[model samples]
Target: MPEGIEARLQEFDRKLRDGHFELLRQFLAKDYFGYSPGPGEPAASDRITDLVTDLKAALPDLTVAFDNIAVDAEGNATAEVTVQGTHKNELWGVPGSGDAVGWTGPVSIRAIGDRFAVRLDDLATPQRVGLVRQLRLVNPADEMDQPPHFPVVWPEFLLRLVFTGEVGDRPCSHLDQITVSDPPVSVCEQCVESDHIWPALRMCLVCGFVGCCDTSTNRHMAQHYQETGHCIFRSIRDDEGWIWCYEDDAFFDKAMLDRVG
Candidate 1:
C-alpha cells in the first residue's frame, strides 16, 4: 500500500529484467543477506546478483511477473512471482532440452529508505532443483558415507501399538500407510548423511521424507516441513504411535488418519 515501497519493488523487478546487476546494488542495504533453508549464514547480495546473471545467460528471454504485493505497516513487502524463460543452456547440472520452464515462488524484502534487505524464499530454489530432478536432466549426485535406512533397529514389528485414540477431527492423511507397514520405514531418510545425530525422528507420510526431531541440533524435521509444505509427520521412535500436523499445530491419533496405502 505504500507508494514508495511499490516503486522500490518495481525498480528491483526492472533491474532483474534488464540484467542491470550493477544498478541492483543501489537497492540493497549494505548489510543485506539472502536466506535459503540451510544451516549456514545467509548469502550476501552479490550471490543473488550472480544467480540472476547465470539465469539470464541460460534463458535470454527470462522475465518475471510479480503479483500479490503486500506491504505491512512496517514497510516489509512480500510478493508472489512467476518467472518464465526458455531453457537454452545447462543450469544446476541439468542440460537444457530446449524447453520452456516457468515456476511460481515467493519473495520477501524489507524496505529501508530507498534500499531493501531481501530474504529469498526458502522453497523457491528447492522447487527449481526438484523440477530438474523430475525432468531427469541430471542424475542425483552420489551420497557419501550414507547412514542406514529405516526399520533396521526394530527387531520385531509391533502391530497393535496405538499412541492415542483421540484425533479430534483433525485431517490426518499420514496414517494411510500405517495399515500396510507396521512401523513404516526404518531410518530417517534425510538424516542418513554422515556425522548427523538425532535425539528422535519422524516420517512424512505424504512424501516419505524423514527429518530429525525438533530437539535435534539441526532440527531437520522442521526444515523439511518448511521446504516441502507437507504438514504431517508420524513418530518413528520405538513404540511411538503419535502423529502431528504442522499446519494445525495439533496432535492426532494414528487411527483417525486416512489410510491412503
Candidate 2:
C-alpha cells in the first residue's frame, strides 16, 4: 500500500476512464500481453499504441476498474481488474450483444527500471462459469434447470480422511504436502495446457498420486472425481486452501458432504 504505487495505478485508471489509451504506452512496457477473454484471440502489445484504436472501438464505454492490486514478494505487480462494456462492434463475430458483460482476470506487470516492460495476462474466461456456481449455491438443483457456462462434473469415487475422530477434524497436514492420483496419469487427464502440471497436490503425501489444478488446461482433478466417482483428494499445493467437492465445484468441510450434493 505504498503511496507511490497507488498513485501510479490511479493514474492508469484515469487514462482508461477517459479512453486516453494512447498514453498507456508511456506507462506500460513494450511486449505487454493482453488477453481478449472469450472467443477472441490473445494479443501482445509491445507498445500500448499497438491496440489503442481497436480497443476503444470495441469497448466504447470501456472503463478499467481495479478490484485489487498486489505487489508480490518477487516485486511483480499484479492487477486484478474487471472489464465491463457493451459489445459495440464485431468481436470474434459474436455480433455485438450490444449487451454489456463483465469478466475478471489477473494481469502481471513486469517492472524494469522506471516502467513495466511486459504485461502478462494468464486468465480470462468469457464463459463465466464461476458466476453459475455462485447461483447454484443459493438454489437447489431441482429449481434451476439452466446449465453453467462451463461444464460441471459430478464425482464418481469417494474417499475420506479424518482427524481428531470428529466430522470436523484438526489439520492433519498443510496444503503443500497434500497429494492425489488415480490410475494412469490420474488427475492429468483433464488439464487444457502443458505449461501447468497435473494434480496440483497429490491425494496422499503417502501415495504421491498427483492431480491437476482447475487453472490447468483440462481440469483433470474434477474429471478424476467424475469419471471414477471418487470423492476426495489431498490438494497438490500447501496453504490455507480447503479440499474441494468436485461434484459441486465447492469447498467441503466434512468428507460426507463432499459428495456431489
Candidate 3:
C-alpha cells in the first residue's frame, strides 16, 4: 500500500467532518461510484455531495470519526466510522427531536492512483433506523396507524413480530411464483426518468421489475402489479428482505418464509 493512501483517507475524513464537501472532491476519482444514488443524481460524486449536504443540513453539528483504517497491497481500504450529531432538522420525513444521535459502521474505499474510485458506506440503513428510534418516530402501540403497506413504520412492525411472535397470516400462493429474487437496477427507472422521489423500492418477484414502494407518490410497484397482474413483490430497501402479496394482502418476513418453506 502507498503511504499516501492513509494520509489521503485521513484528509477525506477531516474534510467530511468539517463540512468541506467541495474540498473533498480532491479525494475522489473522476470515475468514482458510490453505493446508490437518488432520482436525479446521475454521477457518484453527485450522490456523495447530496448525501453530505443533507446530513449537514439535518445535523449542523455533525461529526465523523474514522478509525482502524487498513489498506492492502491491492489499494483496497476499510475503516470503522462513527457519525454523531444533534437532530436539529428534518431527515427522511422524520421531524427532528433536537436529540443527540449516532451510528457506527464499516466503510470501504478503493484507491485509484491518488484518489478513491469507489466508496461504499455501510451505515445508511442502521443510521436511519437508529435516528428514527431516537426521534421516537416508531411506536409499536400505534398499530392502528400502520396500514397493511410495507414501508410505513416497518421496523416497529418487525420488532413486534419478533418479540410477540404474532405471525399475521399464512403465506400466499404467490411465493411459488418468485422466480427472480435479485434486483437488476438500484434506482426505479421510472422515478429517475420523471425526477421523482421514491421512499423505498420493491422488486416484482414474477418478472424482476423494479419499482418504487406504495409510499412513494407514484406507487410504481402497485402500478406494475396492476398493469401486469403480478401480485407478489419483495422489498429491496436497505436491510429489508420481507415479501408482500398484493392479491392476498399478506406479508412474510424471512423467519416466516423459512418456517413455511
Q: Alpha-carbon error at 235 in model 1, in Å?
A: 26
TM-score of 3: 0.51
- 72-103 in candidate 2: lDDT tens per residue? 65556777666666656643222344666565
* TM-score for each predicted model, relative to the true structure: 0.45, 0.39, 0.51
Rank all candidate structures by their TM-score, best first, as comma-separated numbers: 3, 1, 2
Show the lowest summed lDDT stretch of 10 residues, model 3. Answer: 160-169
1-261 per-residue lDDT for model 3 (tens digits): 656888888888888777676764677664443233223324444444555566678788888767788887776888876778898987645667798988666667778677775443543444434544554554333332232222333442333222222212324777777788788998889988998866678999899999998656788999999999999988886477677888875665645555556
How close to the true structure is residue 133 of candidate 2, measured as C-alpha lDDT? 25
Q: Model 1 — which ten-residue stretch has the worst lDDT?
A: 155-164
User: Over 4 Å off in model 1, which ranges?
Assistant: 18-22, 30-43, 122-261
Candidate that beats the other on lDDT, 1 or 2, i.e. the better one: 1
Worst 10 residues of 2 by lDDT: 158-167
lDDT of 3: 0.64
Which residue runs of candidate 2 sit more than 4 Å off their true CA positions?
Answer: 1-6, 32-44, 47-52, 72-74, 117-261
